[model samples]
Structures are given as C-alpha cells and as structure tokens.
Target: MVAAYRFKPVVVVLLLALLLLASLLSLALGPVAIPLDDTLRVLLQRMTAAELPADQVLIIEQIRMPRTLMGLLVGATLALTGAAMQGLFRNPLADPGLIGVSSGAALGAALVIVLGGTLLAQLPTAVLPYVTVMGAFLGGVATTWLVYRLGQSVQGTSVASMLLAGIAIAAISGAVIGLLSYLADDAMLRTLTFWNMGTLGGASYERVAVLALCCALVWWRLPRQASALNALLLGESEARHLGVDVERVKRELVLLTALGVGACVAVAGLIGFVGLVVPHLVRLLLGADHRRVLPASMLLGAGLLLLADVVARLVVSPAELPIGIITAVLGAPFFLALLLRAQRRGGV
Candidate 1:
C-alpha cells in the first residue's frame, strides 16, 4: 500500500523527465543536423546571455524550435483528449476520430484551404489562419454536439447509438469533403491534399502559445473529472447510485474533449492514432484509474508523437514526410488488431 501511494508521483516525475528529453531531442533533430552540444549551446545562448553565430542562431530561432514546441503541445492535447474520451465512454475503442470530430474539422480546414485564397485573400493575410482555425473548431464542435444529441433520447443514452451516430456523421462529413475536393481547382486541390496529409511545417511560436493556452485550460478541467471517471467505470446506472451525477460528468467530458480536439485538429490537420492508441497503451501499462491514466496519456502521447515527427524528418532525409503518414503507419495496424480482439471478446 505504501508502495502504491508512492508510485504515482514517481511515475509522474519520470514522465515529465521523458517529456523534457523528447523536447530536447526534437529540437536537436533535422536535416541540417545540429550536434547535441551545439544545439544545447544555441538554445542556451538564445534563452539566456551570450551571442551566437548568425547561422546557428537562425537554425535554432527560425527553424527547429517552433516546430518542436508545437509537436509537444499538439501531442499532449490529443493524448489528453483521448484519455478523457476513453474514460467518458468507458470503452477502450473511444477516440477523437470515433466521434466524427476529426472528419468535420478536416472538412472545415479543406474548405478554407481550397476556397480561402480567392475569398479570404480580400481579408488581411494575418487574419486568415485564425479564421480558418475558428471554422475548423466550430465544425468539429458542431458535429460532436449533433452526435451526442442523436445518441441521447427519452429512454436514456446508449453507447451503440452514440457509436452509430458518429459513424453516420463521419460518412456525411466525408461526402462533404469529397464534394469540396471535386469543386477545387488544381492549386486548391494540391493545397488541400497537403493540409490533409498533416505537417508541422506551418508551426510558429505564436501558434504554440495559443495551443499551450488551450491545453492548459483543458488540463485544469481534466484532473477534477478523475473521480467522476472512476465512478463511470461502474457503468452509468451504478455510477448514479454512487452519487456520480452521470449526466453532468458526461457533458463536462464531452465539452472538454471537444475543446482539446478542436485545438489539435485545427493546428495539426487530423493527425491520426495518437488519441486512439495512446490511451490504450497507457491503460495497459499504468492501469485504468483516471488519476494516473490521464497524466500518463499526456506523457506517452507526447513521446509517441515527438518520436514519430523525428522519424518523419529523418526518413526522407532532406524531404520530410508528413507526420500523419508516420502515425498512420504505426496506428492503423494497432487499431485493426484491437478491433479484432474486441470482436473476439464480444465487446465490438
């Protein structure tokens, strides 16, 4: 019992250390290849006192740092949302994409990319990305709200209904995306394709700041839901009997998850499997207690994504692959395997 109490804080410390290591590695990596010592020096020179050579300064300031920080924030947000979703639904299969949010956000982003050049060009260039991000966030939230509404009824909520609604909404959103693609001109089509594929190439320190703010908000709300999540594990009816306020918990979790997902897909453009796979891995290693699982998910997700992004950069040498491709390559097989296992277990 003493060991059990001590373990959580120890694990949290270790995870934080791992995150710091991943952040340093991400900043150190890329095609130009700053040596680790030089990289550290450049970072220290920029953050503290001392002058650096122009070339090293440019590499650290103008290139890798923003992208690396963005990766850490994006990874943490997606993973936190994933942990929350799994806890809310009481299902290992639950993920951000499972609720139609990703499809909707992708559609919104594609629309903005495909059409914004002509329409939004009239507006200030500085305002365009913000407009696009707002559109995507709203679209994701809208679709998610619709799914929740469709799933709930006079008889009460059903997981099957929720899953079915999500699938239906996802199909509808996909069709919308297809239509948008068809209407797109050659340049717009190319842009949409690149955006859909997902890259951190567009990340800036400003965007990182915005993402961090959103993540901080979500993180603050999430830990308080731990007891609610624990009660949820007993099933909704039992949870209510245990004074869980099941409906309120569900609502809070849904909104928190949606906000986190919106922040993520807005910046990253539908990077897959972090949400789906990270929580499951966390549960497997750390157990299902939300107090532990939520924090663990954040660490594992950040590491997984940071590692994936590193692999993406190095895989093609000078030409970096899209981060999405790396994650899909890792996540799709695991997802399928989980689906098959669920079928065998009578849980699908």
Candidate 2:
C-alpha cells in the first residue's frame, strides 16, 4: 500500500529513543535537580542491591521516578485512546475530549467525589477507587455510543453531526458538573476544582502500577485491530463486504478506548488535546494507515506529554503548573495551525 511506505524502522526507533531521553531528563530536571549519574546510580542501586546516599536514593526512588513514569503512562494511554477513537470515527478531528467522552467521565467522577459521603458511605475504601473508575468508563462508553449513533443514520457517520452532538453533550455535561459543584460543600468543591484542572502531582508507585497495567492492556488490544481499522477507512459497508466485522470493531474500539481513558481520567482528571493532536501529527508524518498511526501516536504522545510535564515544572519553577494548562498552551497553537493548513487546502 502507498500509505505504508513511510513506516520506516528508523522512525519508530527514533521515537522510542526520544521517549527514553525524555523520561531520564524528567527524572533529572526536577526542583531538587538530581544529577544524571546519581539518577542512574540510584535506579541501579535499588535494582542491583548497591548502596547510595540516603537522600538521593529517596528522591529518585520516591518522587521523580513515580511522577516520570506516571507521565509516560498517562501520555501513552491518552494518545492510544485518541488514535483509536479517531480511526474508529474515520475523522482526524475526533478525540476523547472533543467528543464529550472526557466530560462524561468527569461528570461520573464528580458525582462519585461529591456523593461518596452519603451514597457510598457503606462501600469499602478499597472499592471506592474502582467505583469511580468504573463510573468514568461507563460514562465514556455511553457517550461514545450515543455520539456514534447520532453520527450515523441511513448514510455513513457524519462528522458534522458528531461534532455538534459533542458540543451538546459537553454543554449538558458542564451543566451537570456545575450542579454537582453547587451541591458540593467547600472540601468537595476544592477536590472538584483540582480534578478539573488536571495534574500528575499525586503520582506514586501504587498508582503507576495500576496505570501501567491499564496501559499495557490497551496497547495489547489496540494493535490487534490495526488491520481491521485499515479496512474500516474504506467505509463500513465496504469493510463489511471485505469480511471485516464492522460492528465488532466499533464495539471493541469504543470499549477499549473508554476503559483506558476512563482509568487515566479517574487517576489524573481531564487532560485534553493529546488525543486530538497526537494522532493527526502521527498520520501527517508517518502515514494514514492505522498500523502506523496507532503505535506511533502512543510513543509520540508519551514523549509530548513528558516534554509538556517538564515545561509545566520548569515554567513556574518550584511552584509547578498543572499539566492541563501546559497542554492547552501547546495544543491550542498547533490546533489552530492545523485548521489553517486544512483551510488553505480547502478545509478538512
């Protein structure tokens, strides 16, 4: 296929190398500024049973490491989810945030946080996390299904309809969130405020482990659909004629995207644009083929977020900014540029 010509081995290698470099730099360039050599030494020290200075070991082991890893997981997950969502919808503009999936997840999470006291008081602390996450996942699935349905009729999926539905869903979701905020007391309101802002400041070993597991599951599942997604781009009827299971593919992509994204949102709140922008960039540079788009988007997405997280930390210095702000600053310009370019080319 002409599309697969750009899938160079070197591109994947370079992306991976960049991701590794960003991860290490993230570990080194924090407020305390752990040296690269010391960072390596401490990481190996823990793995190889060697001794290092107590404070340095603590910094690498406890603080920067978890945060860096969390950034990687969150970035990769959002990108993967984004790529899959775009492919499923056959629109480069599709994204978890743009299509109201994140809003739904946020609504679910907000409900959990605001009502946990009265409604969920009897639930065990251990199950509370899963409850919120499941709520968010269900919300994503529901919104995605609704959007997909609305976007489809006797004809193919209508990008315009999907976009409009997303706007309506976002408006309704925001109204619901505002209602939840109104009902919330000061403490719950504060929690909701932070969740809305979105940060990775709470990263820890335990959370990273869960994020890793969910991300791994998504990575495993998404690539398997690459060929099917390729067939899908030919249109649902054509794909079905070619023996592709259109319904199954849609269901799988929706659920998998929702599951991974919901977990990430449940953990890190709503971080936007990574999904919308990264996949388009991947397709632009590499190819439109889902085989290339999906994996590259994941890697580049991780690298982009890590770079953003780094900027988020360094821009405000010791008083680190929330990552969502950093992404907005970066993504907004790129988005506008994309739109302008598409407009110049007679519009997307």
Candidate 3:
C-alpha cells in the first residue's frame, strides 16, 4: 500500500528463481557436502531409473531431498496462510499463528505423543497413520470457528474481539499442554519438548507426501478468495455492497488457513516467522493484491525457510540448531524494527 513494487509478474518469477536457488544450495551444502552438478545428476538419475554412486544417492535420495521438500511445503503453507489471514483481517500485523490455530494443533499433536499408543490403544491401526494429523486439523478448525463465533456481536464482527478470543484460546490450550507435559513420561516429555522448536530432520517420503497434499489443498482454495479479500479491504459494508459475501468468505478463509497451518505444524513441529514475516515481505515486494500476495508468499516463504534450514545445518557443523531458532533470530528483530517504524508513524 505504501509503494508499488515494479513489474509485479516478473517479481513472482524472480521469487520462483530464488526458491530454486535455495533448493539447489540446500541440496548441496549439508554436513556431507555434494556438488551442485552431482546433486542435479543424482536427481535426474533417480527420476530416470538410472544408477549413481551409492553414497551420493543415499545422501540425496534419503536425507537432504526429503528435508528440503518438506521445508518447501511447510514454509509455503505457513506463508500462504499468513497472507490469507492478512487479507481477511486487512492488517499487516495479522498472522495465522496470532489466532489459536497453531496452539490448538500443537495441543492435539501433544495428546497423540503422550497418550496415543496406550490410552488410544483401541483405535484402529488403519486410522493411526493419520490420527495425529486429523486431530491437529480438527483442533485448529474448531478453534478458528470458536474465535469467529465469539468475535461476532449483534452489529458486526470485531477485530479486537477476534484477537482477544484468540488470546484466550491460546492461553487455555497452553494450560492443557502444560497438564499433558506433567503427565508425560521421559520419552513423551522429550518428544513434546521437540515441539518447542521446529525441525525438519524427521522428514520422510510419507511426510513429504502428506504435506504435499495439504499444500495442494491450500494452494487450490486460497487464491479463489482474492477478489473477495480485495473487496473486504474496503470494509465489511463495502464488501457486502460489492457482493463479496463477507461472512462466508471469512469462514472459508479462517478454515482454510487452519487446515494448512495445522497440517504443516503437525508435520514440521512449530516453525515460526514464515507465517509472520513472509507474507509481509511479499506484500512489500508485490503490493497488497491478494492474487499476487498469496502465490508470492508461497515462493518467498519456501525460499526463506530453505535458506534457514541450510543455516540451521551449517551453523553448528555436526550438531544442528533447530530451524525455529534460526527463524526466531532472523524474525524477532525484523518484527521489532517494523513495530518501531510503525510507532514513529503512529500506525501502531
């Protein structure tokens, strides 16, 4: 809104280029370094059912590739959700995680980690593969619905009330998580503690497939609301006058955001900053149009997180820092600086 980014469509292409650059760099620069050309060769060989050096194939096909792919999907999900939320709320400060979705999803995952095999022992084996993901999705959707319902007053929807309700739900979920933590054994506690920071080290083909589905679901649904979001930017009455169906749009946006974020959180633990930062960066680079914002957010977010994952791997050599830490270190200061600038202009 403050300024137009020059040549919008080209910028989206450049973002895709950046994501490709990050992917190649990520595939090459791990603890066990593989040359970029060799990485490409290995990838091609795998695709064509050709043979390669066993060691090179093992590292690329088994380890780094899945992690990189998961990073792309999870990052895209968070950033897309954030962009959608900002569009819905008509504020740059709006992040998907600002609502209770991430916390609710985290709580659901914690429940599975703590009690799944024992307390949920009777659950069908076929359902176990997806139980955790389904739990997270349902939790997030339920929380979003509750917050939206609470925010609706006789006159209209209240952004303040929505934010406040989100805070309340987050607080309650945190308390429940604390209780779960108390009940967990050492093993469960260790697993639960991993949720404190996001990591993609556990990435697998199955997870990559699952997150791809979630990303596909999100990618399919979000851009459809671009026009409605643009209308809502003019305020609820104006959106209604423009035939935007404000309530339905809001419901659809919130649920879709929940679905995407919940699935990513379930798979990736709880990466932050992608949702909070990437969409803002996209808007600053590509303008406020939701159509441009959503897809651009996906590319930039994937690139940023892949870059972060590379740093996470290299920062400590043999030991890796959590991806969340890298993102927090990067994001926290950016957020503070943005806040300071906004205050100077009295936009806060």
Candidate 4:
C-alpha cells in the first residue's frame, strides 16, 4: 500500500501523457488523416489568428476538435461519477448508471425519436436537434431525483435503498424504451437505434460548451469530497464517527453524478463501460484511495474514450461504428477477466 502511494504520482503522470497522445491522435487521425504537424499548426493558427489552408482549418476546427473535446469531457465525467458512486456505496462494482441516469436518458431520446415528428413539428427546424438533447438531460435528472426520493426516509438516505430503486427505475425505463421502439416507424427506429448505440457525430461547439460546463462543475466539486469518500469507505457509522456528514456527502455526490452523467448522456447517448471500467482500473493501479482514484480515473478515462473513438472511426473507414460498441467490445472482456480473477482469489 505504501508502494502504491509512492507510485500514485507516477501513474498520474503516465495517464496525463497518455491523454496528451490520445488528444493528438484524435485530432490527426480520421477519414482525412491530417498530418500531426498540420493538426498542431491548425490549433496554433486558431489561437494566433493566422492563415492556414481553408479546408484543413475547416475540418479540424469545425468537426474533429469539437468531437475530441466532447469525448474528453464525456469520458472524464462518466469515470469521475463512477468513482464517486463506488465510494458512496462502498462497492467497487458500482457505476453512475446504478442510479438509472443512463437508462433514463435513453428513454428520453427514444421519446423524442418516436414522437418528435408530430409533437415537435410546430417548433422551428433549427430547434429540432436540441429537443432530443434537452429531453435526455431532463429525463436523466428526473429519474435520478425520483431514485433519490425513493431512497429517502426519516433517518436519512439509504444507499442500499437507492441501489434497489435505481435498478427498478432502470427496468421500467427499459420497458418504456422498448414500447417506444415498437411504436417507431422504420426511419424513427433507425434514428433511435443509432442514438441508443451512441455517437459523437453530432458534436458542435454549442453542445461541447454545455457539456464542458457540466464537466467543470463536477471536476471542481467532486475532489473536495475525496476525504469524506475515503472516510466513508470505512462504513457510514465510522464515517460519522470521524466527523463526516454522511448524508450531505451522499446528497452532493448523487446530485453531481446526475448533472455530469446527465449532460454526457444527453450529448453522446448511451456510451457505457467507461463509468464501470475506468475507476476499477485506476484503483487497481493506485490503491483504493479516492484521492488517487478520482483524478487518475478522469485522465485515464479521457484517454480510453479518445482511443476508442479513433478505432470507431478507422474500423470501417468512411462508414463509422457506434462508439458505444467499441467501448463495450473493449471493456466487457476486461470486466469478465476481472470477475474471473476475483473469483480465483476469493475476493468476489
């Protein structure tokens, strides 16, 4: 454990390096395959207000830049929330979706897809795209609020109750999504399918700005709870004995997780596994310290998502794969391996 503590800084540095490399690769590699030097030049020119090839500048600034930024923000938010949820629940396998946020967001997108043609037709054409995003964001927030309320009692919020409530909510949301899918026409079904599968294709500066604000809020606030989280790991009674306000910490963590993960699911759709996988990997490398887990999860999560997006882009050339599929393909096997190892070690 002391060795893990000593190595934490080194792990952080390595994750940062990986994030930087992933960012560069995300910018340079795509269907057009811009050179690394050219990508750097374009970024520099954007700040310096200098001239560059209009086409190259247009592609980088208008498309890939926003996508890459969105990936980083979404990845960081998911992983950060996942770590917080695990700490709050005192369960290593807990993820942000354990609160039903992702399923709720999916249900929201499904609603918009199935009904938007008629119900939203009166809205201006330019306003249509945002309807789905807003639907998703609101849906996630609403569901999380419901779950929180269900978990409340005279004593305080119960983490076990919350976990069970989340599971129930997720199941209901899944059924609703299925019903919506059944009601959708072929085109609507296709759109809904893609949205559920996840994509960064809709990324724009506008969407990125909203998600960045959410990410910033979460990042700014969550680390402050690191000590409380560390304490809580010893159990709620012990955390209270140590002078931590367990209830307040739980409230803050839930609220922040909802905001961050809601915004991410709103923008990117149901990209899973980052929340479930990244934090566990960070803990494995750096010990079960929330202080080490949180920031390291953010860095590693951003790098992992960026790399996954890269593979999604290249796997089929001009035709892209859903990034959710890429993450699941990469994450699921690793997760199963973890389960197997835990069982072998009698840790499960």
Candidate with maximal lDDT: 4
Candidate 3 Cα outliers beyond 4 Å, as residue runs? 1-5, 46-52, 119-127
Q: How well is each residue in 1-348 modelled by candidate 3, as lDDT tens digits?
A: 444565776787889899999999888887888888888888665444455567877888789889999999988889989888878877676676777888888888887878674856687754553677877888788888888889889988877788788889989988998999999989888777777588988788887887788779789989888889889889999999998888788888888888898888788877876788898888788788888888888899999999999999999988999998999899888878876886898875
Q: State every prediction's TM-score relative to the real structure.
A: 0.91, 0.93, 0.93, 0.89
Local distance difference test, per candidate?
A: 0.81, 0.83, 0.83, 0.85
Off by over 4 Å in 1: 1-10, 46-52, 115-119, 153-155
- Candidate 2 lDDT, 1-348, residue by residue in tens: 354455567778988998998898888886778789978877664444355567777777788888888888889989988988778778777788888888888887887888766766688766666777777778777877788788886776787788789889978988988999999999889878766878888787777777777778888999999999899888888899999989888888888887888778877888889998999888877888888888898899999899888888888788989899989888888878877887788856
Q: List model 1 lDDT by residue over 81-147, tens digit each.
A: 8888878877888788887887777777777777666888688866666777777777778888898
Q: Can you give the lDDT of residue 85 in candidate 1?
A: 83
lDDT of 3 at 107: 84
Q: Which stretches of candidate 2 lie over 4 Å from their true place?
A: 1-7, 47-51, 119-124
| Candidate 3 lDDT trough over 10 residues, lowest sum | 44-53
* lDDT, residue 208, model 4: 88
Higher lDDT: candidate 2 or 3? 3
